[model samples]
Target: MLPRSGDVLHVTRAASVQFLRPITFRVIRVLDWPTYDGWLWLDGYELNASGDAVSRRSIFVQREGLHQVQTAPQHRPHTVRTARRPVARTPVRVG
Candidate 1:
């Protein structure tokens, strides 16, 4: 984590976090140790309810301290059209 601070941290990871308790103080503070890292925290009901986020590789992970250059759009069109829809009659979990 140290290398990314000033190229001090070599690796950065984005992971899910759950906080069980509520702090009564109106103001809040979050401190990090020597590691050069960041957070992607979700609080309770707001966490998994959104279909946009799932259990696996759910979030877009990117490297910090690096700028992302926009890429040109691809010239090819999508192989499938908008009318395509998957059959929804599949079985659900029995559990």
Candidate 2:
């Protein structure tokens, strides 16, 4: 699958020989520079195990070998609360 901006990828040896050690990458953009068919250049950040970007880099890899990582859906707690009635105020006589 073609990667887009904000896509997270699992880059391994399958993608390129340069990546003997696999990496988690977050795509910043796909470079338009011309290259051989089935291969392209990517500009992105190398992500750590914690899913945080460690460094920015440009990578060249085969399109067929790129693996996209599925992100988990965020869960938000839903709660309901009753509205409170306004308090009444007493009027005082002024001299």
Query: Evaluated with TM-score, which candidate comes out highest?
Result: 2
Give lDDT for model 2: 0.90
- lDDT by residue for model 1 (20-78), tens: 32111110112232333453211111113232222221122123421312222345775
Q: Candidate 2's error at 60, in angstroms?
A: 0.3
RMSD of each: 16.7, 7.4
Count of backbone collisions in candidate 1: 7
On residues 47-74, what C-alpha lDDT tens digit does candidate 2 reach at each position?
A: 9999988999999999998889954345
**Candidate number achieving the greatest lDDT relative to the actual structure:** 2
Q: What is the TM-score of each candidate against the true structure?
A: 0.15, 0.73
Assess the local accuracy of residue 44 in candidate 2 as a C-alpha lDDT between 0 and 100: 94
lDDT of 1 at 33: 24
Error in Å for residue 45 of model 2: 0.3
